[model samples]
Structure formats: structure tokens, C-alpha cells
Target: MSVLDCGCGPGTITQGIAQIVAPGKVIGCDLEPGMVERAAALAEGANLDNLSFQVGNILDLPFEDNTFDAVLSCAVTEHLGEPVKAMSELGRVVKRGGVVGITRTDWAAHMIAPSCGAVNRFFELFESGFNLQGGTMNGGRNLPSMLGEAGLNVVDVLIALSGAYTPEPGNAMVNGWAEWIENLPLFDRVIEEGLTTRDELDAMCAEMREWGAQPGTIAATGGCRVVARKD
Candidate 1:
């Protein structure tokens, strides 16, 4: 069946979806033209003839109504200022009886064993900055109801926990996350707003690194996955 991968950043998951629906059309849409270009290039490099990429915003998708057989979006709604509007747009594009799947990370459910105060401070500041930037840090849990509100029937809900167990120093799981934390725009916005200083941020990152270095250090986060159907 045809599918649309909304906010298909970098085409990582979109490529997988294309493979799943081989010979069926799959369109990956993202807001950034660069991302679209990157996705398209990756798809071409992988010889995924069934996949295509386009520039589009979730709030206002470029497709006509009932265009695709199904729609799938991952890790997108949490970043939107108008998440329900975006969901409605997804519903608008899918044909009748089509499925819409969304997966979102729930920051409120994020857990760290032997938690460090510095890490806590970091998340607090980060989440505050995220909200200030018109994003929700822990909106994953509400997506099922949001889908229903957007005129879709909720079919299933799955809560999955992703974790790093005793990760080595500079491993991808913990280190990659730390790196992403270091580069997030939220921290920059937080600094610009005078909410915190860069020095403190550096200290926090250092402490978090030390915490991750400790033996048996574990970090876990939850992802809420929802499946809805268009009536």
C-alpha cells in the first residue's frame, strides 16, 4: 500500500518503510529542503525506487485529501506548536480506513540510574527552553487522545522503553545522546534568554559525562506509539 512518512528526517525510517512496501509508493515529507534533498539522495543511493522525498510542513501538508493509503510520522508531534492541527492534516491525506502511526518520545518518563543533580538541572533547563521554543517536552502520552480529537479512531497504544545499559565511554547510545544534548538549539535559546550561562551548561555536560562513565550507569527513555485509523 502507498504511504506517507511525515517529517521523515534524513530518511532513516522512511527507507525502512519503503522496503516494507516495495513496489508501492512511499513519500517522505519534511519541512527543510536540505532534509528533503538528503533523504532523496539517500533513497537514490540505496536504489529505493519506490521512495520519494518532498518539502512540506506537517501543519499544512502539500498533498490532496485522501491521497495515500496510510501515513506514518515519528518523533514529530512533540516539536510542533500545533500538533493537533498537524494530526488533522495527516488524517486529511489518508484514504478512508487508512492507518496513521505516530511515535513520540516522552521526556517526563526519562530515567537515569544513580541520577546526578547536574543531569537533572540539564533536563530542567532543556525542557524549559524547549517549551519556550513552542515545543512540548512530554507530550507523547497525550497523542492518543489528540488523535481522537483530530477525528481519528485510536486502535492501539504501545509504550516502549529504550535504554543504554552499562555503556562504554563514548559509545553511541550515551555519547550520541550527550552530543545531541550539547548541540540542541534549546540550550542556545536558554542562554540567550539569560536563563542560564554557557559555563554552567558546560559544567553540567561534564558532570553528565562523568555520571555516564560510572560503572553500571543506566539511562532509559520511553516512547509512546499510537495507531489510529481514519473513518
Candidate 2:
């Protein structure tokens, strides 16, 4: 069956879906022109003739009503100010009896072993900044309700808790959290708001790295996957 992957960055998921559906087509859509170009190039390199990429807004999809047999999005709704509206659009594009799958992370549910008060404070500041930027840090918890509100029947919900205690420098879970923390502009906002000082932030970062490298330390995050269908 035909599929639509919303915000299909670099066409990774789109190509996978295309392979799964074989003769069926998969369209990868993203709002950024650069991402669309990158996705197109990747699909081309993979020789996925059944896959294509397009630049389009999630709030206003480019297709007509009931255009796709299945629609999927991952890690997208949290960035939206109107996630339910986007869900409505996703639902609107799927034909009757089609499936819609969405997965999102709940940042509030993150767990870190050997937790320090300073690190927790840092995360609090980060959450504040995320809210200030119009993001829903707890969006994953609202998926089922959003899908139901969008007139889709919620069929299944999967909760995946990811954790790692490896000392390896590039461990996906550890490195992912570290990279996200390092790249966050929230620290700047926190400093500007007088919530914390640069020295304190630096200290926290050092502590985080040290804690991550220590034996028996663990870092974990929560993800929610929802599958819904249009009846």
C-alpha cells in the first residue's frame, strides 16, 4: 500500500517503508528545502524508484483528501505548537481503513543514574526553554488523545524505554543525550534569564561527562509509539 512519511528527514524511514511495500509507492515530505533535497539524493543513491521526496508543510499537506493508504510520522509532533491540528491533517490525508503511526519522545520521562541536583536543575532550565520556544516536551503522553480527537481510532500504544550503561564514547543513548545537551540554546536562555551562570553550566557539563564515564552509571529516555486507524 502507498505510504506518506511526514517530516521524512533524509528519507531513511521512507526508503525502509518503500522496501516493505515493494511495488507500492512511498512519498517523503518535509518542510525544509535542504532536507527535501537531501532526502531525494539519498533515495536516488539507494535506487528506490518507488520512493520520492517533496517539500511540504505538515500543517497543510500537499495531497488531497484520502490520498495515502498509510501515513506515518516520528519525533515530529513535539516540535509543533499545534500538534493536534497536524494530526488532523495527517488523518485527513489517509483513506478510510488506512493506518496512521506516530512516535514521539517524552523528555520529562528521562532518567539518569547517579543523578545530581545540578543536572536536574539543568534539565528543568532546558524544559523551560523548550516551552518558551513553543514545544511540547510532554507531547508523547498526549498522542492517543490527539489521534482520537483527530477522528482516528487508536489501536495500539507502545512504550519503549531506552537505556545504556556503556563507557563507549559513541554509545548511541549516552552520546545522543550529550549531543542534545551540548547543542541546546537553552543554556544561553537560562543565563540570560538569570536562572544560572555560565560557570555553573560549565560545571554541570563537566559533571555530566564525568558521571557518564563512571562505571555502573546509566542514562535512559522514554519513547511512545502509537498506531491508529481511520474507520
lDDT of 2 by residue, 35-112 (tens): 999988877767677888899899999999999999999888888888899999999999999999999888778777
**Residue 101 CA displacement from its true place in model 1, Å:** 0.4
**Native-to-model Cα distance after best TM-score fit, residue 141 in candidate 2, in Å:** 1.6
- Residue 195, model 1: Cα distance from true site in angstroms: 1.7
Cα-based lDDT for every prediction: 0.86, 0.82
Residue range 1-231, candidate 1, lDDT tens digits: 999999999999999999999999999999999999988887777888888999999999998999999999999998888899999999999999999999987878877778678767866786788789788778888989999999999999998788888745532355555675689877888899998998988787777787777877777877899999999
TM-score of each: 0.95, 0.89
lDDT of 2: 0.82
Given candidate 1, what's the lDDT at residue 10? Answer: 96
